[model samples]
Target: MKSKYYIITIVNVITMTIICFYFYEQNKLIEVTTNNDTRPIELLKKIVIDSNDKSAYNELRDAYLNEQYHEEVLFYSLLMANITHYRQAYFDFYYLLKYADRSQEMKIFDNETRLLMIEYLKKGAALKHEQSMHELGDLYMEGKYVPKDTILGKKLINSIGL
Candidate 1:
């Protein structure tokens, strides 16, 4: 109930922010403050006061996202993935891990992080997360990380009608 409103409010705020940015870009007279620190601290305090506040947590995650705090985003995203067990959360993890830096030894991620990413994806897929299945399947098909199994990739993708 409350969460739905929070989501809508967040969406509205994001949409306005985007519109403001576009206008600011063209006019060069207005200054956009996407990097404002006021929001994160307030949200953090709210979270500290009540750790179970999902709305605060969600807003804090979005704040981290807006601030481009990758590790913080990843941490909250991992928690969300574990807590919600939803396709969107798993997709967040997948999207972050996909863009993570690789080692000079041709590793997609550091060994532990890579394994963790794979483990999360596998669990998400087993739980029938559509995005997880699609991304894991894509990984298999790409043959970049882990063993390449086109058959398995196709199977996973096809399982989701992708």
Candidate 2:
């Protein structure tokens, strides 16, 4: 009778440990699925369907930023700008201007787009984005986008220790 009781207790302990470990692993799997299931293109389509979804915009922005999607970053930045989401707009625009090629292939080099890019760059510079400040300073020094303002350009460059 004593031996049977001991065997039963040992079996119960093993079963409980296995059950606890199984549940813990299931919880981890759920967490991973939740993190990885959100796709950027799907979020973009959702944004297109309902442009007022702020959370979707934020999620798409974060996802695309993580993926290093430059054109999508520019698109979302401009969209945010149109909605007056200035902080996110500035961040996204700064990244786009800092990393993207402003040629025809990127479809962002037209005169109007160039002006818009400069506008966002100036706003980003005002927010103290170092790269935007540097790029805008270079543009001003070279008269590439806005009218030449060498004084402001030099001022910006000096501010960044470059």
Candidate 3:
């Protein structure tokens, strides 16, 4: 029947649309982290063997940064923070997350990423990291990601003598 053929055509169109959307998203992520440079294979192998290896993380982050692969650098920074709880790594990761592109995973992690970034700032503040305290205070004042707590923000600012 003509109706049956029409239904099949509609189904095919929908399937094609889904396939196109998938490839489009993949292409977008690649475009966001575009690079013709080679990956640090040896460092990656070292990281695989020892996730807590700060040396490998530093090397990887530096290499990616030198190649202008900011997203990769951000990933390495986050890993360093998670692995070693380094104060500066936490700060770097938090700031980097702010400017991160939403070309990742259908953008589902955008809000989640912001929440994680706020948590990093909070940790950095707890560690008495001055820059983190200053930045978190401003974030609280502006309510950029966390809930607006002007009192807490002022206290943080004062604590840092800023």
Candidate 4:
């Protein structure tokens, strides 16, 4: 009877220790995450590698968005487009739209990336950027940004005339 009691006590203590350790580790992770460090990007990379970690994915995406990491935003957007096509990818797509450099534009690609490209062109047009107007006209002419509507493309090109 004494041995049974001792074994039960040991098991109870071991279980409590494990639970406490888990909480402690979890709390530590929270602390690390809250700190303004680039480690969150690393964590995001890990979550990308393990698609099963949905919570981690959300956290990492939020962190990257907050940090304004354009490349990371583009990557996650494309990844989501490829895997799930979730609406959140649109938010990342918008981020990329606002920040992507012109030199990097060629790399911004996916089946659904046209929507983002069109948004960028519109933004440029709104800002009166002649280059964007020309690009948009060309894309329209070539059926890149939208279905080829030669009439509309010619109209845009003639309006821009460049």
Candidate 5:
């Protein structure tokens, strides 16, 4: 009986230690801070350089957006969108459309690019992405690319439980 208790106690200690280590690692990943010695952008850039860390990529995206770095926003947004970060991707595309005038400047915002962007939104919507559904619905309702369909827009918004 004493041996059994000792073994159980040892096992519990090991388990607790493992749990603590796991939480520590997770917290480390999430604890991004701007300190006097390190700028937030520099840390963000380091995180982005690693590239496999999605959370860091998201932080970088937000940072770029806050700074009005349109091109960087587009780049990170596209990356996030491709990886199923649908809402961020949709908003980024929306921002580009609403502000950048990339099409006019580069002579590329023709029918093809518009259609492509619409398709991207549709893909996200198909995945039950809320912003994509909302944006696509709005576009449909406004007849931005296709015929106006208020019903579809309402349905999309409704699906979001909003």
Candidate 6:
């Protein structure tokens, strides 16, 4: 009847809208990947398994180049926090705090990354990472991120050797 037709039409419209929204998000993520020339995390994983693979690197670069603004910002932010690259765990912790949550699925590298950061901080207080020392100093002064330990903060800053 007329009522049934109206309901059907509304359901179809809603379904189409949902589909459109999904594609829009996909395009946005892809656009972000391209603009920054960052490879999608998936592609980056392949390159990790094959360090000398130029093709993988090229794919990564291409994806970044095609990425959108927001995606690039997020990508670079994560890149900066990469423990293997920076080893300054505090920066990663603070940086991740912006977007991370318990419900999020753990990436393959997440555990190792966190462990390395913790180890680096504990062993040498991020000796080569200037920002870590600064953060440590701030944490000591503020007693917010870390326990109040002025002596430890001073020693960490000095250890950075910056």
If scored against the real structure, what TM-score would every candidate get?
0.55, 0.51, 0.57, 0.37, 0.61, 0.38
- lDDT score, residue 160, model 3? 81
Write down the lDDT of every candidate, Cα atoms only.
Answer: 0.60, 0.60, 0.64, 0.54, 0.60, 0.45
Model 4: runs farther than 4 Å from truth?
Answer: 1-41, 52-54, 101-162
Would you list the clashing residue pairs of candidate 1?
none
Clash pairs, candidate 4, are none
1-162 per-residue lDDT for model 1 (tens digits) = 989756754554354335434543454322223244455444553463346454555565566566555445455555566566654556666566555554234544455455556766787788888888888899899985669999999999999996
Residue 72's lDDT in candidate 3: 57
RMSD of 2: 24.2
Best by lDDT: 3
Model 2: per-residue Cα lDDT over 1-162, one tens digit each: 989756754554354335434543443322111135665455453564366465666666566566544455455565565565455566566456545544336554445444555666788788787877888889889987679999999999889999
Q: Write the per-residue lDDT of candidate 4 for residues 62-150, one digit (tens) a residue.
A: 77556544455455554554365444553444445535534474654443344544654555554555555565667778986478877
Ranking by TM-score: 5, 3, 1, 2, 6, 4
* 1-162 per-residue lDDT for model 3 (tens digits): 989756754554354335434543443333221133344545453573377676555555555556555555555565567668877767867766554544454543345446666777788888888999999999899987788999999999999887
Over the stretch 83-156, how does candidate 6's per-residue lDDT look in tens digits? Answer: 23434323433333323433358643343333433333443344455665666665676665357888877776
Worst 10 residues of 6 by lDDT: 68-77
